[model samples]
Target: MSSITLYSLDGCPFCEKVHDALDDADIAYETEWVEPLHSDRNEVKRVSGQRAVPVLVNENSGVMMAESDKIVQYVEQSLA
Candidate 1:
C-alpha cells in the first residue's frame, strides 16, 4: 500500500500545486480533505500543529510536513 497521505482542501491553490506535483510524478497517494471547520480543522491541527492545507504525510519515510512548495519538492525528489 502507498504510504503517502495528503491533507488538503478544495479550491486551495497550494493544495492544487501539491496535487499536480503528485500527478506529474505519477505517485499514488491518498487524500484527506481538511475541511475549514470543526472536525476537519481539528484533524489537521492535531497532525501538523497548524490548521493549514497542503499537508503531506509519508508514513513510509516518517515524513509529515506542511507547505505546498516543500511538499512538491519532496515528492518529486522521493518518487519522481
Candidate 2:
C-alpha cells in the first residue's frame, strides 16, 4: 500500500493538478475518488474537515491537507 492517499474527484481541475504533480514527482499514491456532490463527500470531510477535492493524506508523515498548490509544493519539497 502507498503511504500517501489523495482524495479526488474526476474531471476536477484542482484534483488533476495534484495528480499531475505527484506523477511528475514520481511519488506513488493511492487515489480515493470522491462523490460528485459535496454533500456526498463524507469521507473527505471526515478526513480533512471539508469536502474539497485534491485533499492529500500522507500516512507515513501524518500530514493531511487540502488545496492543489500546497499539495504540489509539499510533493516537491518533501515527497519528491
Candidate 3:
C-alpha cells in the first residue's frame, strides 16, 4: 500500500467526508492537524499553495491534491 498523508482541521465537512471515505475503504493514512500549534506549516502551504483541509499527499507517487472529490477518487485509484 502507498503511504498516504492528510492534512486536516476540525469542523470541516469536506475533511470529514474524506475521512469517511478512507475509513469505508479501509485505507490507512497518516494525519497531520494543521492547527495553530503548527508554527511552521510551510509544507502544507507549499503543497496546496494555501491553507486547506483534507490535503491528500501520495508519497508513492509524490502527488499532492486538494479537493474532497478529487482526493477521494485518487485514493480509490491508488488503492485499486
Candidate 4:
C-alpha cells in the first residue's frame, strides 16, 4: 500500500465515505482537515488542483485524486 494522505472536511458525508473505505481496507492514512469554506480549500487545490472533499494523495505512487467513490475503489484495489 502506498502512503496516503486525505484532505477532508468535517461533517462531510463524502469524506466520511472515504474514511470508512480506508478503515475497512485497514489502510493507514493521514488526514489534513480543511475548513468547510471555499477559500479554505487551497491546500486541497494545491495538491489535487480542485476544491473538493475527500481528496486522496498517494505520496508513494504519486496518485492524487478527488471524489469519494473513486477513492473507495482505489483503496480496495490498490491497498487491499
Candidate 5:
C-alpha cells in the first residue's frame, strides 16, 4: 500500500470536493490541515511552489499537484 498526503484547510470547498472524490474512489490518504499559524502550511508551499489548498502529494509516485480535477484524475490513474 502506498501513501497519499493531502494538504487541506478546514471548510475549504475545494478540499471538500477532493475529500469526496477520494471517498468515492475508495482511496486512502493522509491529510494535513494548513492553517494560518496552526501548522506547516509553508512546507507545502515550499514543496509545491504554490500556497494552494487541496494539494495532493503522492509520495509513492513522487507526484505533487494542486487543482481538484487534476488531483482526482491523478488519483484515479494511480489506483488503476
Candidate 6:
C-alpha cells in the first residue's frame, strides 16, 4: 500500500478535486471509496472522526485530515 490513502465517495466534487490534485502531482496514493450514505461511512469516521468524503491520510507524514482545498494544498506543498 502507498503511504497516502484518500477516502472518497463516487460523484463527490470535492473528492474529485483532491483526486485531480494528486494525479496532477504524480503522487502515488490509494483511494478508499466510502459509502454513499454518511451513516454508512464508519471507516471514514473511524479514521478522520467524521463521515466526510475527500479525507486524506498520509501515513508517512502521520497527517490525517478532511477538506478538499486543504488536502490539495497539502499535496502541492508536501506530497507534490
The per-model lDDT (C-alpha) reads: 0.87, 0.94, 0.81, 0.89, 0.82, 0.94
User: Which 10-residue window of candidate 1 scores lowest in summed lDDT?
Assistant: 34-43
lDDT of 4: 0.89
- lDDT by residue (22-66, candidate 3, tens digit) is 888898888877774445666789777877677988788888899
Candidate 1 stretches with Cα past 4 Å from truth are 38-40
lDDT digits (tens) for residues 1-80 of candidate 1: 67899998988999999999999999999998878664559887887898978899888889999899889889888879
TM-score of 2: 0.97
Off-target runs (Cα >4 Å) in candidate 4 are none
Query: Model 5: per-residue lDDT, tens digit, 1-80?
Result: 54888998889898999888888888888888887553457877877887778898888788889998898787677763
RMSD of 5: 2.6
Number of colliding residue pairs in each model: 0, 0, 0, 0, 0, 0
Residue-wise lDDT of candidate 2 within 1-80, one digit each (tens)? Answer: 99999999999999999999999999999999999999999999999999978899999889998989998999999998
For candidate 6, the per-residue lDDT at 77 reads 96
Answer with 1 or 6, whichever has the higher lDDT: 6
Deviation of model 5 at 49, angstroms: 1.1
Q: Please provide, for model 4 over 1-80, each residue's C-alpha lDDT reduced to its tens digit, 9 standing for 90 to 100.
A: 43789999998999999999999888889999998897878988888888878899998898988889999999888887
* Residue 19, model 4: Cα distance from true site in angstroms: 0.3
Which scores greater on TM-score, model 1 or model 2? Answer: 2
- Superposing all C-alpha atoms, what RMSD in Å does each candidate have to the true structure? 1.6, 0.5, 2.8, 1.9, 2.6, 0.5
Candidate 3 residue 38 Cα shift, in angstroms, is 11
